[model samples]
Structures are given as structure tokens and as C-alpha cells.
Target: MPDPGSPLARLGVSIQHLLPQRALTALAHRISTARAGWIRRPLIAGFRRLYEVDLDEAVVPASGFDSFDSFFTRALKPDARPPASVGTGLLCPCDGTLSQAGPIFEEPSGGRIVQAKGRDYSLAELLADEKAAEAFTGGRFATVYLAPYDYHRVHVPCDATLRTEIRVPGRLFSVSDATSRHIDRLFARNERMVALFDTAHGPMAVVMVAAMLVAGIETVWDAGLRLRPGRDVARIDFDPTVRLSAGAELGRFHWGSTVIVVTGRDAPDWVDGLVPGRRMRLGEALTGPRAPGRAEN
Candidate 1:
């Protein structure tokens, strides 16, 4: 983690605040979604080369995608990311760097989760629901950062039923390492889609945060999520729930972004060696098998 007071980091974040983030992202969306070969093909080819994207892991070949956006969010080969055995804790939700992993602190006013090495953000502000945030008191949270070259789809960590979906509109800031360190409450301040799931162990929330140039975020159930910029929260409560198994696709980012997964108190102990900058892939176990005597909710 970079120093929070670093002058260079502060300057970068200050510059980001002045940029027309939404307009730039909209332009990116327009260009990346272009279907014409002359427009999309070269962009895809250049991106693949520049990022050294692993074509072998992708289900679709580089040339098969109709547009650059499709290529960026392409599905992987079936065997590329296999789920851990049933009892092995919960699965990792995406392919990215483990930016932060630790407990959600029970503060006097509200809950707080680790944002970076030296910063913290409020739990209620993050979920945009104080009651929902209370479920994770003293619980665990893992922050994964998807880069431009990484797989963008997020997955279910365990067998769970979708309980709630929330879209909290905010700034489209860059979620880069420097921004995370310099910008206070970086994840909570960005536009996010919060998915609450009811697992056998307890409630789990996956907060998918958008960054600059991240044109959109869509889930398996909801294809297109278009929200007007505002402070109001958009939410859905599923009475007839959607059950999802470990490794099932939950949602995907249009471009690079961040995901914060928070588990309730009843969840299994997180696996050891969860250090910063640890590279993770989808479906990898985050904890060991469920312990004896732990019952379902």
C-alpha cells in the first residue's frame, strides 16, 4: 500500500476528481461496443497484445468476439476455473489481486471495513443500508481488485439464495492502488451494485464497485443496469429467490473494478495466508471445509 500522505498519490487523485468520469466512460462504452470490424478488431488485437490476455483460458477466441467489450468480458473454458470440493470453505468470487482481507470492525457509531493499509470505510455507507451492514459485525471481508487484463465476472462464493440487490449511484473514480490509498473511502464512494445472498452459514454481501471507464455492471439475472446519477438507492427484494451455487456467475464488470465480499459472524474461518497483492482466481477456496457442529441457517 502506498502512503496515504504521499504528495504524488494525492495529486493523482485530485486530478481524477476534476475529470468528467461519466462522459469518458460513456465514450468508452460506445467505442468498445462497436460491431464494425475495422473499429473493433484492431482495438481487440491491440488490447490482447498489450495486456497479454490469456486467449487459451477464454472460451471464445480473440477473433470470435463481435466487439471489444465482449472480448473483455469473455467467459473462460470450463476447466479454467473449477470449484473447490463442497466442504472446502467458500470459493473466491473473481480473478484479481487480494487487495485487503480482514475483519469488519464493530465501531461505536457504525461498522467499519478495511479499505487499504491505513484507511477504513463505513459499512453502512458501503452497503447503503445500515440494517444490512449490521449483519456483518465482527465478520470478515475480502477485497479483490480486477485489472483491465483480469477476468471481469464475479461468482457466488457458496451455495446461496439471492436476497437483495442494490445499486448505489456515486462518482466513477479510478480504483487503482494509488486512488485506494489516497482517496478516503474509495470503494464506498464509487458507484456500486450490492448483492446480498443467504448462504447456509449466514448472510454474505458482495459489493461490486465501478471505476473510471467501467461503462456498466450487469448480473446473470439482470442484463442491463441503467441508473440515473443520484444519492437515492435503487433496490430489489426477491420474494421468489434466486439460488446460486458456488462458482456460478453472479455479475460482471464492463471493465476493471473492485469487489468487496463480506461474510456474517456464523461463516467459517477465512483460510490462512490472505496477504495483500495475492493473486487469486475464481472458484479457489478461501477457507477450509465447514467445521463439525456448524449448522445451516
Candidate 2:
């Protein structure tokens, strides 16, 4: 929970219930995508200073960026985040603080993932696809939260072929831990892009959840997601040839957001020592083989 004494906490409450989220997000998109020097340069510099972003790890220096969007989704140096030695079942998808991680629980309607202490949201609501949600029943889920200072690009956690991408449009709410405790079904209520992948272990789903002031979400294949209020969920099927190796670039958020990774029932168990609030780097080990005598899902 956020300190009630903090101004940001109060602002979050106001924005969640009172602000026109879509309009604000669209305005942010325009400003972030602008290439004009006067508009973009200062914003980039200001953000860098405010967040204390480390430019040394970036592929290009901050001065070389033409737009705030480019800097926000900048690539890292080749050696900056090399994948952990092979044979680890999964890898961390992005640099962020681990919000929560554990096994999914089955329910009468579907499986449920923890959103925060004492709060859980249904898998069907989170994915917006009932049949697709079933694949993750009794599986494992990890939610990582990216702050403004973290790298916003998300990568593939393991070798997998892209199967489907589902775009679900909803409110652009703040996903900070403070808000998560106060807002019910926060992730399910936000506009998100769900990408399903088929791996040697089984199926995996990477859900990129959008938050307040987040301009857009993009994939290596699709330019950007189209999110409009009142629009029905949109899903795209990928070609079987579309494949990505572990640690390869998968997608990115135009601004900081959250990534929730869910694996199928047959997926490997999470490595020991995982705890909420642990900071993670891209390409680090996330899972290992199941333990002996473990009950099957």
C-alpha cells in the first residue's frame, strides 16, 4: 500500500476516479511522438535527469535521440544484458521490480492470479479469451512493474513461436503498487496487449499492461496496438514461421508499464528464492525443472 501521506498517492486516487484517462493518454502520445527539437529535446533531457536514467548502457547517446519515444524505448548495449547460460527454462523478460509471483489457482469460472494482497483477478478477464485462459490453469505467473528509470523494452523469456496477439481496450489506470491495492481488477481493467507463444515446455502468455500516461505499446511485428474505448477485443494470429529465440526483443512500451508472464500447466517451476519486490534484469533465469514428486497440474 502507498503511504497515504504522499501527494502521488492522493493524485493516483483522483486520476483513477476523476480524470479522463483516454484523452490524457492521447495527448501524451502526441507529445512523446513529436520529433521537433524544441518539444522533444527538453522533454527527453528533463525525463533523463528526473529519472536518473543511465545513458551508458544505451546503444545510442541521449543527445542522438530524435524523439522522446525513441529514448524511452532505447536499445541497450549488446553485452549489457546477455541471457543467462542456456538450459534455464525461462528468463526474465524486462528490467523491473517483481510485483508478485506464484502458481495460478483454479476457480469455478476460471483460474485466478493475484493482483495484490487479498485481491485476485480472473484469468478469463485478464486475457479476454475463455478458451485461451484455460491453458494457464494451475500454471505459474509473475508480474513485473517497470518504473520510469527502468528499460521499457520487453524480451522473449524463452525460445518460442508467436501464436496469437490479443488487444483488449479499457481504462488507462495507474498500475503502481499503491493503486493496485486500492483498485479492483486493475490489470484486467487496463488496456493491454496479450501475446501467446508456444514453447518447447508448453504455452506462455506475455501480457503488456498499459498505465496512465503510457502513450502506446508496440511489438516487433506490429507497429503499435490500436486501443479505443468501447471497441471489442481484437486478436491477430501469427504465422507459424514467426519465431523468437530466448532473450530476443519481443515488444516495448512507449512509456513505462507492467509485464505479466503466465505459463501453461506443464511449464517448469520457478527457481527458488523469488520474492515480491526483487529487482530483475532482462535475460536472467526465471525457472528450472520441476522438483521430484511434485503434483502435476
lDDT of each residue in 3-110, candidate 1, tens digit only: 545887788889998999999999999999999999999999899889898899999887799999999889999999978774836889999999998778887988
Residues 1-297 of candidate 2: C-alpha lDDT, one tens digit per residue: 558437778676776788888788889989988999999999988997888999999999978998998999999999999888759489999999999998898878689999888899998899889998998877999999999889999999999999998989888888888888778899999999999999998889999999989987888887564533238788889765579988999889888989999998788888765688899999888987556776644
Candidate 2: lDDT over CA atoms?
0.87
Model 1 clash pairs? 87-289, 89-288
CA RMSD, predictions in order: 3.6, 2.7
The reply for model 2, stretches above 4 Å from the true place, is 1-11, 86-88, 225-230, 289-297
User: Looking at model 1, which ten-residue stretch has the lowest summed lDDT?
Assistant: 288-297
What TM-score does each of the candidates earn?
Answer: 0.93, 0.92
